[model samples]
Target: MKFTDGYWLMRPGFTARYATEVADVRAEADRMTLYAPVKHVVSRGGTLNSPLLTVECWSPAEGVIGVRTTHHAGSVRRGPEFALPGAEQGAGVGKVRRDGEVVELVAGDLALRVDTAQPWKLEFTAGGQVLTSVGERGTGFVTDPAGRHHMLGQLGLGVGELVYGLGERFTPFIRNGQVVDIWQADGGTTSEQAYKNIPFHLTNRGYGVFVNHPGKVSYEVGSESVGQVQFSVEDQTLEYFVVYGPTPKEILRRYTALTGRPALPPAWALGLWLTTSFTTDYDEATVNRFVGGMADRGIPLSVFHFDCFWMRGYQWSDFCWDGETFPDPEGMLARLKEQGLKICLWINPYIAQKSALFEEGRQAGYLVRRPDGSVWQWDLWQPGMALVDFTNPAATAWYIDKLRQLLGQGVDCFKTDFGERIPTEVVWHDGSDPERMHNYYTHLYNRAVFELLEQERGEGEAMLFARSATAGGQQYPVHWGGDCESHFNAMAESLRGGLSLGLSGFGFWSHDIGGFEGTPTPAVFKRWVQFGLLSSHSRLHGSKSYRVPWDYGEEAVEVTREFTLLKHRLAPYLQRAAQQAHATGIPVMRAMVLEFPEDPAAATLDRQYLLGEDLLVAPVFTDDGTVEYYVPEGTWTNLLTGAQLTGPRWIREQHGFHTLPLLARPDSVIPLGADDQHPVSAWADGVELRVHAFADGAERTVEIPRSDGPGRTAAFHLRREGGVVRVTTDSPHAWQLRIGGPDGVLHSYPAGTSEAELRYES
Candidate 1:
């Protein structure tokens, strides 16, 4: 990805042609085209031998500008492309202005300015302030010694500007000096490879850039040019969109609007999930023991998952339960559902040779084939495994029919895994470019299954525990961090990945509770239990060993119970957060920098995150429970204990296994549900509007959405005047008013009483 040897020279075997001054400009109603020769044209003969790059600029939506630079206009188009649902709306109405030497296109508050008389430069501005610019030699077409072509573009980065979000990167939270490739791989948490590789990055300077390439996009963030983010693709053209937002949250909102907004997962999917870990020997009896164990310990569990090995060995994706392990699949699922537990089954898109459906897929031309017309088979995860041709609608229908059969037997959702291992030498059924389909195959694979689930279940009720994704993959509700080691370092790395993914337009993310590679130590297990239960979706999963808390220690069981109960109690607040994710693209678990973009202190802090808009969570990563976290400027109150701390500073504290730093921001009202046994309940039945450090004249209206269905919501209004806090609601159910301060106090009101007041000393 890096092209320069140093500041003054290019690396060997590389030749580059840069776009010079613009020769001519053609302005249209919705777009503008710039014709630039690679050399400055003082005479007509100067444009004869050199390449003339064609640059086209337009707006997809308000505040988003798309620029495409091409060397050749006759290249064949590819089949697989990102689905931009918002493009059809045509919200970006452009007004073009042609001054003496400058041509400008204004869309909403954002504008693109080009000076035809100067060297090729494209400057993006908002409110007359430059956000970023493409300067001299910024747009390039390069060729190596092998005669392969590449198109690249570089955007300027200001001093002290920080870059984040290239799709679930675990390397470092700040991607300033890293060489990142937007290629999907199955490498675990410790490697530079990522499962979800989105070629989008937002900076601290109030703008984001999304490379509209689905295949391989190589990025050098502040590394190639030392002052710009350079992205290149091995193609004849390069297209990217620059989105302007004065705030990080707004940037994500605009970005997701262009791609697709994340679907709202059901409320029950937000609760604690217990999974039969991968490679572990689990049968009906083992599942019963784990389910009964959690119930006996008073731990709230909402979903029970069965990982791989549910099918017979070497027969993955058969969609049939192994009769020996699960003799009666329907009966087992029915009994588990009777106990109020939803069911999830592990599945992937690959069909092994031993599977019963493999022959059907191969015979029907539903499997990817090599150039010689043979099925592309591999022996990596499973023996003689072939990928399902999702590009073929018949293949997708065949695959969905298998899963539909399982859904008929009472399976609620699926853990769609291993779409990252697609092969590039194979041919897609729809004649998509093979190199492009390597990363894009997951999108089709997940979309087919997700749409099927939406048809079977309702719209908001469909969810997937998907692992691999691309730019538009946020349409699926929930995604988890892939394989991680059972250790403190891996735990912190997982948080970094989640924060990065959240910034990349994903709304909900989760991880393995105690890691996936090894059996965690007691301290690791207990600490991870607290962290995982606080995530957007919590699941206890591992590889060789079971993730039952009792296997670690009795303290682990207690820690798991405490956090699971706390998550249920926090469901009202979390559900609203999830709704925000559905409406906008703001993630449920937000990075500290995303929430506090003005605070330089929060730019690189990835160990901690904001659980929602109100609560800040700093997961304990040490064995002794010692954690150091930064709190933005506020008088934050701990939601766990009645403790207050003034921040704009760092706080170091040692917590027990049962607690970590979960603080509510000042001047926030958190809706606390009364039920601790289940996430799906009447959230407004006996809720508590916990008011935290309201200002003298602060006013807030909180809407609590019901779990039963849409359109059933409870509204509560609160206003603080002098020393009195008055609360009023339009709900028929009883509720309480809790004021948070140094001494937390609670006051209750009857169901028929619609108004209440509490006097407190300021």
Candidate 2:
């Protein structure tokens, strides 16, 4: 996508034109139109050649500005636009101020300035400080060899400006010096390609730019020019939105308000999930053994996922249980559910020729077709597989009927997989352009199943362990990191992908605990156990192998049990965090930069992340069980070891299999459930409000939402003055209180108590 040869020359057979001056301007209520010819018209004789580039600017919602530049206004635009929230443009209202040859449109806290005189420029400012600007030669109309017409825009990159969130990238957490293409692909965890490529990026400078195109967007982040973040899109118009954060959290809030926030997944979906891994020989006996083994070890396994083998081989996505492997699926699912487990079966939007549904789909015109009106079939992962044409309503209904049968068999969730393998050289049912539908197919594919789940099971009960997503796919609940190798490097790569996805507005994300491509070593398995249990969603899945903890070693099972129980205890806090995400569009598992935007040290720290704003989880990525992590300015308390440490510094330590560095920030109140029997939907019987180190006037609120009804909620303050400490809460729920850091317990309050007001004086 790069056409510039070094800094000054253009590549052969390619030429781009830039506007040097705006010749005329027209102003409306909330929008401004500028007609800028490629060259300045010095006189009436000079206005004789080339097309005028039409650039229009406006504000959509508060703190957001949109700019659309076009070389040809007659170009046709197809369907399948992003599913943005219906907010009126300039909902917060804005004003136009004209001064000399400069016109400015100022929205709430954000202003877009345009110059009609010499050196045409477009600048975006927040609160009077310029964030980024489109300086000289920043806009170009490109003409390349293939006759492709593209509009490119370049924004100034300030010193130390690091960009993040082009969607689940595994290359590097800081997206500088990288050429990122916003196109969804089936590429795994090791490649520069991503499964979910959102065309939005947030910088450490408190601003974000979202390319308003569903098609592929080419981004050269400090790569092409080395001084600007340049983005280009094919066609006549380049439309983008500049959203002002003023802070990262507010940036996400406004962004998701424009797009959508994740629906709160069901409580059961938040707990530990054990899967019968892909290509593993699993029948009724094997599933029972794995499920029973976890129970025998007192491990709370919430969801049991049956991978691809659930359907007969070569007949992928038949939506029927393999008769040979699972003869009695109904009775089998009932028995597993009797053991307090939810069922999730893997399904994709493909119908193999060998499948029983293939003939039906092909005959009913429910599959994608070629130009010759023949079903577009491929033999990549499945033999002669044809994609389900979700663009057709009847085809979607036919697919839904097949899934409804699985729900009848007690499948509580669906692992909507393989939407990334969608082909672009085909004809869609609704006549949607194949190129545009390539990435947006996942949204439709998952939406069909997610809506069906909501129809069957009531609202707030639908959950999907989806693998592929694009922009606005956050409306679906949970997505996991796709295939990864079984190693420390792959573990870190998965975390980077999840953190990047979180920055892209996804609320819940997970990954395979012990990796997905192969079996993990015992040390790696146990370490990933702690890390997985800390994610927003936890699951044990892999390819060509089983992910049971016992398969690694007894130590793996012990570590799994310990962390699973700890996660179960942390469910109250986790669920509240999820609710906050649903409300505010912030992620449950956030990157440190999201919580600590002021700390430049946190902008690149991908190995460690903050789990729900209070606890810092640094997963050990070495065989020696040592980790190096950064803590922002604070008096932090280690949650696992009860040791208090002062930071704004880096700490490196080695540990054993049972422990990782789990720390709690100062002045935080962490809630723990009393029992680990049922990790989902169970009310806290004897809740323990673990209060960490605090200063006077520091208060914390804990809100626990229940499935059956409104759950118990509490807020308390911690104050230490004149050699005395006091704690207070207005909660009516019965709970105990514990005071201390990780080093040792200060005191434990009696159970069945609602409030504990104690004074400590020396």
Candidate 3:
């Protein structure tokens, strides 16, 4: 992807033609088009032999400029392009002025300028300051020795500028020294590869660059040359959009508006989930033992997942329970529901040859086929597995019908697994380019199952434990890090992957609590229990071994119990974050770089993350329970302990199995839930308000869903000045206030008054 040998030389055997100056300009009502030649046009003969490049500019949405540069306009337009929502049609024309040899097109606060004289340059400015510019020789049509042509664009990267979010990458948080290929792969969390590779990356400088292509895009982020971020695509034209935010969160709000935002997962999905481990012997009795053991130990398990073995071997995704092992699945599921647990069944897009649906799909042209018109089959994961052709409308309908039947039975949700091993040599039914369909297939696959879940359950109640996704796939509720070994290292890698995914525009993320590949040690399991219970969604799953808390040790069960109830008690605060993620595109789990952009220490910190906007969680990564974390400039109070700390600094401390560093941001009000037994609707009952680190002139507002009416809620406002505080609410229920401090809860209100005045010593 890198074509530069040094700062001044091009790679051998690769030819790059640069646009030297604009030869002709055509100004339209809504856009501007230009023709730039690759050399000086001193005479008509000079213009006749030079290569002319076509440059078109338009406004997609407010504060966004879409630019398309073409080398040749005669290339075939292909299918399977990325589905992008239109910004706004027919621009209102804010500013269009031609001064001397420069033409400026302004949309909102973003302006783009092009010089028509010699030394052609395109500069993008926001708020009258240059954000970035495509300088001389920056835009080129490149050709390599292999006879393949590419369109390349090199943008300016400022000093100390770091790029992030090329899509759930596990390499590093700062992408400055990395060469990234925006291609999806089956790589786990251990390598430089990624599962979901979105062709989008933004800088810490408050602007985002989204390559509008579904096919492969290669980005050289300050690696090929010294200070240029270069991107290339193998095509005749390269289209990209420059979006401005002036802030990291605002950048995501605008970017996700162009892509998509995540759906609000159901309230219960946030609680702990226990799964029947893959490749383990599990039946009705074994599953009962695991679920019963959770209840016996007072660990509230909300959703029970059945992994791959739920169906018979070599017959994966038959959408039917194995009759021999689960003869009374309907009755068993009903009984489990009676115990107040939801059910999740594992399903993938693959259909094995032994499955009855394989022939049904293969005959209806519902499977991806070979060039010879035969069904494409593979033997890696399952024997003779074939993929369902999601590009086909009838095949999508056929797949959804099976899920509808399962929903008719008692299945509450599904773990849609494995759309990553898609084949590029096969042919799609709808004539989509197979290579482009490789990553976009997961979007269709997840959307089909997610829509069925919404149909069976109500809107805002559907959820999926998915594994594969591309850009805009965040509309599905939840996704987990795939296939990791059970160890401290894998736990840390999963955290890095999840944090990267959160920055990549995913709202909710989860992972195997105790790892997924091998059996974890009791220490690792217990530590991961604390980390997993704190995630947006938590699930205990592994391969070749059960993930039951007691299986590790007695202490592991206690650790699971301690954190499960803690998360249940924190649901009110967590749900508010989820609602915000659904409204905006910000994530429930955020990287420190996104929240504390001003702090230099937070830019590269991956061991800790911010849960929503207020809580900072640092998962103890060491076996000795020692952790080091950084706090931005403020007085932060530990949510569990009343102890408080101040910094713009790092602190190291050792914790027991029951505690980790969960800090509340200064001047914040966190609503603590009442019931530990249920999470769906008990948030309002007996809710306790925890007020943390209030300073003079600090204001806080807390709200919790009311237990009584439809869409009803209760709210309270607290304003603090030194030792005196004011409280106000208009709810009929009684609530208690815990004035958090090092000493303890100084005062507790027995009954709620409309207005109260109180004084407490800090």
Alpha-carbon RMSD to native, per candidate: 1.1, 1.8, 1.8
Quantify all predictions' global Cα lDDT against the true fold: 0.92, 0.86, 0.85
Superposed Cα deviation of residue 476, candidate 1 (Å): 0.7
Give one digit per residue, the lDDT tens place, for model 3 in 87-178: 64535643566889888878778888997875878888988888888887677789998989999888898878888888887787788989
Model 2 poorest 10 in a row by lDDT:
753-762
Give the Å shift of residue 592 in candidate 2: 1.1
lDDT of 3: 0.85
Residue 2 displacement in candidate 3 (angstroms): 2.1
Compare the candidates by lDDT and give the number of the best one.
Answer: 1
lDDT for 244 (candidate 1) = 89
Which segments of model 1 are wrong by more than 4 Å? Answer: 741-743
TM-score of each: 0.99, 0.97, 0.97
Q: Model 1 over residues 174-218: C-alpha lDDT tens digits?
A: 999999999999999999999999999999999999999999999
Q: In candidate 3, how many Å is residue 240 off?
A: 1.1
**Residue 203's C-alpha lDDT in candidate 3?**
82
lDDT of 2 by residue, 21-120 (tens): 8889998877888888888788987788777888888887878888889988887777678877835444536677899988998878999988676677
Error of 3 at 601 (Å): 2.1
Where's the lowest-lDDT run of ten residues in candidate 1? 741-750
Q: List the residue pairs that clash in candidate 2.
A: 641-742, 642-742, 642-743, 643-742, 643-743
